[model samples]
Target: MELSDIRKEIDTIDEQLLPLFMKRMDCAKKVAEVKKRDGTPVFNPVREQEILDRISAKAGEYGGAARIVYNTIMSESRALQHSLLGAGKDLRQRISAAPKAPRRTTNVACLGGAGSYSHDVLQALYPQAEPSFFSRFSDIFRCVEQRQADLAVIPVENSSAGSVSEVYGLLMQYCFSIIAAKTLGVHHCLASRTGRIADIRCVRSKDIALMQCSQRLATLQLPLSEISSTSAAAELAEKDVGIAAVCSESAAQQHGLKILEPDIQNADNNATRFVVISKEMCIPDDAQKISLCFNVAHTTGSLNSVLSRFAAAGMNLTKIESRPIEGKDFEYDFYLDFTGNVHDPKVLELLCSLEDELPRFHFLGNYCEMK
Candidate 1:
């Protein structure tokens, strides 16, 4: 047969499959009604696995491909059930009960001293708020938890270095909600009190900053030392002779150090994303994004099944990151960022189903995305 004839036949098959798919989805909706009446959860992993096994066995040579297709179909069916049954009604109500707008005046906590990137972003996000600086990331969380600060600004990820694994771990430990997020362009500079690169014998900065500027530091042949933050490094460089710091220009200027070399980072377009976390949940009117953390069962296809929930809802997943669960050998917790407001019925249903089905799940927050 000619290629065109084959294509026509495939099109005809698709037309026939459309009604059958709709019929299956209608049956799924009915199943959801019965489940709701019986107080049964929408997700049934054991049954899903059984169906997958049966279909794969029937497909024989095409078992792998068949499993993929059926998996997707099953996921869609679950999503339809969730929507029909209003899966996340409680969660949706909770989110809707939150304040419509964030407080105008608040106390904010951020890592590093004056003029640091965290400080700069915090200032931009909450200009009228009181700011407290901390030496450690955990300290920021502690301040918020203790009610000493109303919100905390944290560097969650760097575009060049990937996700800050330590920050993710801290997030898992803390019960704070992420109310907002911002990204700042990063430019590293080598600064010193001497105002000359020739007199510098050592360099100091945060470990991540030092790594970002490794190539330039190596070229200058200076020994690198890790400090609590770039702001602290600037302070050290200002007080000690024969020492230089790799930090933001603002930080160097704040500490009265002269810039010896600017834009020293290996990547020209380096940037870091910061999250504003608060003790109370607040969903703004313009909020269009959500962050989530979850852990799936250890069974086969468990992770895929969880992720399929999002795809089934037609939600766009902007980011998905995994961090090892503490003391759990090979187990991991996943962090997900997706584009959707919790107020959307479909999105809320998906979230509700995830909360019900996953071993562990957290709705980090619903917030606006700022670049």
Candidate 2:
């Protein structure tokens, strides 16, 4: 057959395929109704696996390609069933019903002391709020969980050193909701009471800060001490003439230490992203970003299948990271951030589908992004 004739036949096949696809989806809707009535879950992994195996066996030499096609079809069918059954609707409703604006007066929790980056970002994001400082990140979460603070500001990731994994683990442990997020540029400064670099014999700061300024610290040949935070290190430097702190300029100023060198970090464009977590969930009117985490089956292409859902819905994913599941040797939990508001029907449908189809899933938050 001529190439043009073959193309015409392919087009005809697609036209026939569309109606069959619709009919299959209609049957899926009926299956959803029966499952809803029987209080059955939307996803049946064992049955899905059986169907795929049967189809692939019948497909002969094209088994692999056939499995891929059937997987897409089944995934769509599952998503449709989830939406029809109103899966995840309650959480979506709660998110949509949350307060549109944060309270004018709020108590906030932050890691480190008065002049750390978390403190600066918290002040910038919530200028009027009262700030309670903590030495450990866990304490920040605890403060919000116990209602001692209305919200907790914690660093989620750093542009220079990648994610703060401890915070991610704490997030899984805590029950608080992330209500807001902001990114702040970081500029490390070397501060001392003597106001002279020559007087410094040792440097102190948070371990991450020390690492961030390793190139400069190596040149100084100073012994590094790991303190709880940059602000704490600055406070230490204020009491000792020979001790210098690797911290923010604001911290040195707050602690009455003179900055001998500024912007000493290895990278000139270093920044840290912070998330504001509260006991209650809230989705503001201007919210345009969402964060979620989920686990897929250990089978091949499981993760890609989940990601394809977002792509098919025209959602733009901003970030994706995988962390190993605590007890499982090779299994991982994927954390994802994508552009879409909870009010968008496509976004809601995707979330509902994932919640129903995935073995483990969590809707971390929907919030506005600030740079």
Candidate 3:
């Protein structure tokens, strides 16, 4: 067949695909309604695993690239589900379920601009919160410490990368509690003013941003410069010539930059988890978890002893982190998150026991269900 004939056939196929895509989205929306009614989580890891396996099994039938189709479809499915359950639900709801009057205005401080990932997570988690943006994580924490900001959002860990040690160290010094938690998928790209792939000179990004895109960047022989953050890199590109930034799409739009390329991270499954911190304790409705930090006595089975406390109380522990106490060479403080609100009888009993046994202790916060 002639090339024009082939193009016409492809166009016809595209016309058919659009309707099917809309049908799929409609079905996805129904799924969201079911989940909300049943109080079931929107994300199903087991179902996702099954889909991956089924796709891999059919690799031989799709012209030797079965894995590609599986991945693309899985990604689309996840994105669709996320949208249906997240902002879409809010839009669909008839009432303006805007947040209740802040028990007190939570002046939250976070790294970067209005549309940065941290900011996005904050807005989702606390729609009524009054957010204040800071250029650095240290600055964010300081705002909370000085009462300039009532709370601060800090990235603690990533699924692809490991724990953020700097934040861990800061946690030890600050008198703040891990009041809440949020996990966000990190989708990055190489954004610039030009669409051409070859007209790039230097790629500017933060250290973490570069590390996330290391494998992809290695494929292209270009100069790499480290900046303060992904947003800063993007801002720099707006003022400089022949420069691009490895930043999020939200950041690109906020900085008035265009996406020359998208999804340039080394791994498609990149995600970051952040913790909300505040100087004062927060008690919210639907509270399920209580966080505490303390130092164990110098003795063997000390860590085990702490774990036994939860077991004794019939409580489940969610997180445990140890950090070195400043000015003390060997001493360490352990942070713990366990099931049960502070108001629970068993939880109160556990706290009383820990106070009698442990040397130092601080209660972070009892977080309510954000969903």
Candidate 4:
């Protein structure tokens, strides 16, 4: 077919698709009503999978790739269906729900201004809470510790990269409790006002952002200068010539910088997990995770014997970190978390056992799952 003819045919098909979409949604509403009447679940993963498979098989008969069209249509259909009724209501019902919103005057602090990873995490995790930004991680920690901020989000570890050693050490030093935690994917970008990569000379960012973008920066072999934070880097690049920032998209937009490259981290699957800290323990109703720290005896198999109690109780440990006992020779403190709640008998038994085994220990706190 001629190009114009193909365009004409596509336009005609799009017009036809509008009515078909309406008709399909009408049918879905009927299905919702029927399910409601029968007290059946609104979302059925098995049925969704079947629908995708059936549509993909049928779409293959047409000109384009089956899976792509199938996924797009299925996602829209599922989303519409969910809106009509509710998505995954049964599972939500089973969950002991938490507070619907952040407490009044719930001030939160993290490492940056407006568009850093800490800011992004604050937005995603809270969505409704008021946030305060800081340049230093220690400042972020101090805000919560001193009651200047009600809570703080501090990065602890990454999947692609290893642990954030600074955050771990700070956690040990601070008297805050790990009230909540979550993981966010890190999507680094090389941003500058100048469009061309060759125009870039000095690169600026936080030490961590610089580390994350080390591979990309190494390729350029430019003089690397460290800034206080990613937001600070973006701020500098906004006013300076021949400079670029390794920062988030939001930061680039805020500072009127352009992204010369996206996802420039050394590891493709880079992610950083953060902990929500508070001076006083305050976990929501739907809390599923607990973090604790304790001092174990300076003896062989002491740590192992304590961990065995959790394993025996069928509790899964998410993390175990050890920090040196300063000024004390050969003594070590351990931080650990497992599946069961602090209120649960199994966990209580383990805690009691740990107290008996270890000289000293403290419960950091239990926290609600973010999502």
lDDT of 3 by residue, 197-248 (tens): 5768999987887888988888878989998678888888777658898999
Question: By the lDDT metric, which is better: model 3 or model 4?
Answer: 4
lDDT by residue (260-340, candidate 2, tens digit) is: 999999999999899988778888888998988888999866886788788778999999888888899899888889999
Model 4 root mean square deviation, Cα atoms:
19.1
What TM-score does each of the candidates earn? 0.95, 0.91, 0.67, 0.69
**What TM-score number comes out for model 2?**
0.91
Against the true structure, whose TM-score is highest? 1
What TM-score, to 2 decimals, does candidate 3 have?
Answer: 0.67
**What residue runs in model 2 are displaced by over 4 Å at the alpha carbon?**
1-16, 58-62, 103-105
Question: In candidate 4, residue 91 scores what lDDT?
Answer: 25
The global C-alpha lDDT for each of the candidates, from Candidate 1 onward, is 0.87, 0.87, 0.72, 0.73
Better-scoring candidate (lDDT), 1 or 3: 1
RMSD for all candidates, in order, please.
1.6, 2.3, 19.9, 19.1
Candidate 1 yields a Cα-based lDDT of 0.87
> What 10-residue stretch in candidate 4 is worst by lDDT?
89-98
Candidate 2 lDDT at 47 equals 90
Candidate 1 residue runs with Cα over 4 Å from true position:
none
**Each candidate's clash count:** 0, 0, 0, 0
1-371: candidate 4 lDDT, tens digit per residue: 89999999999999998899788868877877787688775545466557656766777676235554544454444444454554433323322242433354367888878888888888887777788988777888877767888788878877766677777767777757777888888888989987577887899998877888788889898999987788889988888768999999999999899899999999988888888877765556556887778886574344654565565568899889887788998777777776667557555545544443346666666776553
Give the lDDT of residue 143 in candidate 2: 72
